[model samples]
Target: MIDLNQSDKRQLLFDAARELFLEQGFKKTNVAAITERANVAVGTFYKYFASKEQIFYEVYQAENEKAKRKIVARIDADQSPKEVVKQFLQEIIRTSEQNAILAEWYRNTEASQVLMNYNQECDVQKNSFVYRFLLDNIERWRSSGQFRRDIDANTILALFNVLVLLDNHKEEIGHEHFPQVLELLAEMIIDGLTASS
Candidate 1:
């Protein structure tokens, strides 16, 4: 009963709405604006989604999934865990800034509310690609005697998450202080994990 053409039209709306949302911000965006931006009729918009919130959710979900995939693809298996983590952190920060939709979604949208309702189990594979890569590499490095055995995988995961969150505020961290903070943080973590080194 689902019409392919209708589905495509809906996606078109989502795409246009995302761009507009990034430019105008969510609180300022509305259903009429989305339809006009999509070059579709208001009735056409209602046929696909009842409101802008639903379209926003779709757009956010798609962007988040794409960003996660791109970040994971940037990781190299040959790299050490520390290097891999650094690459991931850099990629995420760079990609998020470059992708206007993603930047706006995180900065201006109700991301916390959407994330609360998002099904982690359903999104596990799409969302965890980078996480699994990071965790697996951490374990590999530890087993290979490259990193200290005392550093548990869970601890590494926590640190990686914290680093990624911190990287998002790099501008606030300031160019002069960011490197010093990162170096100090990395040294403390590595020293705690390293064996006799």
Candidate 2:
């Protein structure tokens, strides 16, 4: 018998499901496969998740939190607004590329639909840390005379969100040239946001 606590079992299931989803996608990954990968009996999966979709949703949320924590950890108050925006973009792109599950999730329409439904039910978009962080940073830059006062903070934050969305297509955008594209985009945003003398 595989002896494990509730948290351990849940974590094991999540890890196994995430790998399967990344490798085979949400539609192709099944509960039995997840349990097999987790080294748990098929019935044991029910104790942790209601369905494969539920496990995939949890995995997506966990990965999103991990990426957010990484970006938050790198934030520095001493950095200039331009530097901060550039760094944030760089971190988002790096995190998306490094996390195979996240990259795969973005690539799959089925996964995205499930995530969208989950987000709607949870009101996650409004309460997201990334959304709040961008809003707060935009407000701070404007108040500090670093960014243009004419533009709304939400609008600036929306642009940032757009850049993050673009990261999903970085591979098709030419991995060799994606970094340059991001840099150029960052420069344009910084220039547009900068306060006039």
Candidate 3:
């Protein structure tokens, strides 16, 4: 049921929107700017996207999807859960920094909220790349008696979810050394999780 021509137009709009978002950023970019950049009628944008926020979310998602795959591919099959989680935390920061729109998701903005909502949805389903990647790793470790059997997977999942919550509170937590803080926090959590081993 896919219309090739319409799909092409939609992609044009999306490509244009992503460029504008990366260049001017979310606050400065508008629908008309996107449509003009895409070389399409303003009305055409409506047919493809509900609003600028929707397109921004899609743009951000594209970046995140790439990051997710990259993170998974970077995983070492022989690594322990602690190392896996540690490397994942580091790689996620690196990838986020590499993508301007993805980095924007860490900021306090409407777009960030949308991105968080996307994460929350994926969390509930337990199907997101990172969630599934970590979940499977945790379960494997738990079964191998490497991770603490006393601690359920959901509790550990909640523990990792703290990272996202902390990102939202960097200003309150002091942004001066937030990266160090995150590194320290990850070490503490990973050590605690692997204390049994």
Name the regions of candidate 1 deviating beyond 4 angstroms: 1-6, 22-28, 39-54, 105-126, 164-191, 195-197
In model 3, where do residues sit more than 4 Å from their true spots?
1-4, 107-110, 117-125
Output the better candidate (1/2) by lDDT. 2
Poorest stretch of ten by lDDT in candidate 2: 100-109
Better of 1 and 3 by lDDT: 3
User: What TM-scores do the predictions have?
Assistant: 0.66, 0.72, 0.86
lDDT of 3 at 35: 91
Model 1 error, position 141 (Å): 1.7
Q: Which pairs clash in the backbone of model 3?
A: none
Can you rank all candidates by lDDT, best first?
3, 2, 1
Whole-model lDDT per candidate: 0.69, 0.79, 0.80
Tens digits of lDDT, candidate 1, 64-144: 777888778767868755566556656765686677666653454365345334433255534566677767877888888
How high a TM-score does candidate 2 get? 0.72
Name the top TM-score candidate.
3
Of candidates 3 and 2, the better by TM-score: 3
